[model samples]
Target: MTAPIPTVFIGGNHEASNYLRELHYGGWVAKNIYYLGASNIIWFGPLRIGGISGIYKSHDYLKGYYEHAPFQGSASRSIYHVRKYEIEKFKKVNSPIDIFTSHDWPEGIERYGNTEQLLRCKPFFRREIENQELGSLPNRTLLSHLKPNWWFSAHLHVGFDAEIQWHGEGSTPYPPADPSKLPSSVPTYPVQVEKNQDEIVLSDLEDNSTDDDSRLAKKPKIDAGGEITNHNEPGCNIPNKEIPVYPPPSTNFYGDSETTKFLALDKCITNRRFLEIIDIDTGSEETKPHTFYYDPEWLAITKCFSKYMSTAQGPDTIPSNIIDEKNPDELEKAKAWVKDNIKDYRILDNFAMTASGPPPKSCNPSTNLNRFNRPKFNDTYLYRNQQTTKYCQMLGIDDPFTAQCPENDTVSK
Candidate 1:
């Protein structure tokens, strides 16, 4: 007799929706075992662990949470697929997470490291490689922004490993288009706007005629030496002293160029590479150095979700007074909002297009039994269990999954 080893899991596209929904924030799925549901980030000592549950599809990316149990028509789609608002928590935190996981594979990741080896191993995936549609586009976008040290994914039932090199801030680099089709001069703006939530109130400012306004118009006094002096301040005669300068600080947590080791495991039933044992040196100077800083550009991209989602969802959620004909002022405000959020809307469109290769494939959720509702017990769970039991039998051990014990022995305090 032996104690059962604890296991943790994140849900995939095929899961018991009701069961997962009960412990959405990831309560224990089994004794001493846990589930990391939806978009959850947790910590284990120095290691920061995070995961996004469920598969990705364009339409399902930005909606309020929905789930249905008992495998109803189309209801299971909402129940299993990752929702739009689920990722909001990720946008709020800018810390460098150590590890990340998802159910669906990240799209176009094969191009980063070694595709030759990948194709040689999984020749059946050649079509997906050619079309660049093997994995999730939203996952690619998130991976680019988060730049975690490692990423693990499943659902493809294939054992694969690769390194995805971070290409730095902004979108992935694209090759130049046709010279004739390109613009004569690329549009360049002198000022680049950094987006944030600070507002400057122009109403508070006044012309020079007002007493408060006079302070704004005041000019600094310039001496013969060409050094400017502040005339308004009383203590403006402080002597200057030279201070020691320090070297520029590093802005990396891992002390190395951000690159993620991505691994996808095969099904346990396959009895081949079913699990991976990795050693993460959390205390190493090369890994756990404390100079990590969040990339603000990536944060901005994450925070833009609400703006884009609003546009994609349309003005139905807009206030009735703002959209209704009764109040013209509010209606104008709503219109202005729509116009202002157009940039984010367009950004989302471009992101989806670039990541997924094409628009998301349209399949009827209600009628598409292959894609949505139909569940296979043997493929998902039972077959794996049976295979494990058979393996145990070959080794002359009792089937751990069904080993019987005395009633007194099974009793717990």
Candidate 2:
């Protein structure tokens, strides 16, 4: 509440997952503080900020939001894992995104940067980086699909910068004369793939072999003074310390298809300051408004795909790929519904605490050493966060989590 500037965030493992579950559609967690929810897009004047919360796991990624409050077993931790059900709706995104953020780095992102330097810092990462098991596979797919101007992520404790060049179809690595001439339709990712532990095996592996990712790692050179120098990565001025960063122009697939600037920072400590401020020209400087806006398009997409939301803890696969929003008429109807149902597109600045703080550890007593029964965490009751309740009410939908419990009790998996 004491934050002087408007702060926004995405969730990682170290959080109260139950509270985040309540506001699945995203909401103000406290005054001037916003949680991006599971997946969403918001507008601040001309800037379209899109984000997804949580890390990715292959097995759980294909499942639903099965873990409920008063979480038990591995469910407590697994609930924080990323799910494909939430990301499927974004496949319907046809518009451009200005900026996007996630809690973890995109898979194979290390290949696009100073990987050699990274390996020198953390030798343990070499195996995963070599095996292509280091980052989020789904996010890498989204990176190509959305092609936002700027992407930010932090999970691996390091500071790095890289750019992704959106080479077009037919195996081309350059944009055409008129980028708008390029296709706006997103590519369909494999609906089901052979899953290995921490890996999604793609059929197109033969074509991806030439990415020369090792060369990208070799691009970074160290001078005698220990400053970082790039061999071939152009227009990127990666810093040893904080410097003014100017975000490249918003990516226009038909124009400059190679404009995504990816930046990931290390954990800040002692004398190192990782904070960077980029001067963005989001329309006009004279009328720089600071207010939260619900993106109508994102809302429409969410409404159309709400039925695909999963809450099963088992192997119940949600047929989310079957959703066909490509038909222009269907999406238009959803937008019309959003307009008619929601009178004000601007999010009201209301924040409320929906659950009590975690009980003090002193309240927990040690159980019998030989007792193997699951410990009861009945001290806290189920909380139906009203922000989500009211948001769903306006959208002419039920709160996916609370609605399942009906009486505001624990949601049955």
Candidate 3:
């Protein structure tokens, strides 16, 4: 019988932690499966100048700190710290690591096109891609040297229809590889020195060429020096009254008749459906009331609203109590009722169904009760401790969560 191939998936951040927990509980945790790194690994320090001075105090502290820490100061120091931490983690793992999976494109693989723009605009990213000197980072270079046959990553979101090869030299953009001609190699084992010899092949299953092509076609043409030029102007602007300001005769009608206004609404609604209900009297645009149709799949609106009524607003403005705290017996019954009826029991009270006035500006209107239940702001240190404890408990591993340090105990004495 063929031996199961060892796989190591590395994901850091909240989304990854949730996914890992689901995978573990869902019976997807295989004997060969290993989480190569911790979920909440980034190290953020205080804004104070000397805060980072005493940062690297211990191995565990330093590991957790730098994993999520910003890559500032000399590139060499940042690269060395990150690489050292990652390599140490890899070494500490007893499992035969073969695959390296991540939610991000390993350092240097982000330079295909518009990477800078994408990174700048992206939300919830722990570190800016620009601050990360991708080519200079040891992780990308060393990954090639260590030679994990497959590297699975997802943050880019766009699919790769054809297999792409990383040259391993630097940020070299190359054409996509033909999937039909791709070779299949035996899964590498720990002792397999030949593992690093093979080229890393990215799966084409996630390729989104149709969207890419459409985006590319829409990109306004630029001159050699990268300046946009108006193709319509002969040399410069030469106003001609005969020429219609708007193209397409169907939309450029000068007459202010009922038919013209109706045609205008039809044309505008085709692009912006929200323009369907323009207030003629107020000269304001409003969304049609009928546009807000009920979607049965929307759990927040369907489930929460059906069972619960909105509560009166308070001075401090906290969510009204969903369970009867004074009565423990009733609380248990309420919890049981929620668990049995609701699709996501953990999130029932989170949505704040009883809260009055408009929700917080940052809050998504579409967010369900379960999503709101989890606190948005996180206390990193406390979160890390809890995550570590939970991970150890779930895996039946030794508890790694530490309280007061040995030095603190000595100081107290």
TM-scores vs. true structure, each candidate: 0.48, 0.72, 0.27
Candidate 3 C-alpha lDDT tens digits along 18-90:
2232222111223434333332111101000000011111112222222221222321122222222232222
lDDT of 1 by residue, 284-401 (tens): 4433322111222222322333222231221113333322333345333433443343222100001011011222348554544333244222211111123223323322334322
lDDT of 2 by residue, 18-47 (tens): 778778899988888888899998766556
Taken over the whole model, the C-alpha lDDT of each candidate is 0.47, 0.65, 0.26
Lowest summed lDDT window (length 10), candidate 1: 346-355
TM-score of 2: 0.72
lDDT of 1: 0.47
Top candidate, metric lDDT = 2
Query: What clash pairs does model 2 have?
Result: 178-254, 179-254, 179-255, 180-254
Off by over 4 Å in 3: 1-83, 91-98, 110-132, 160-398, 404-413
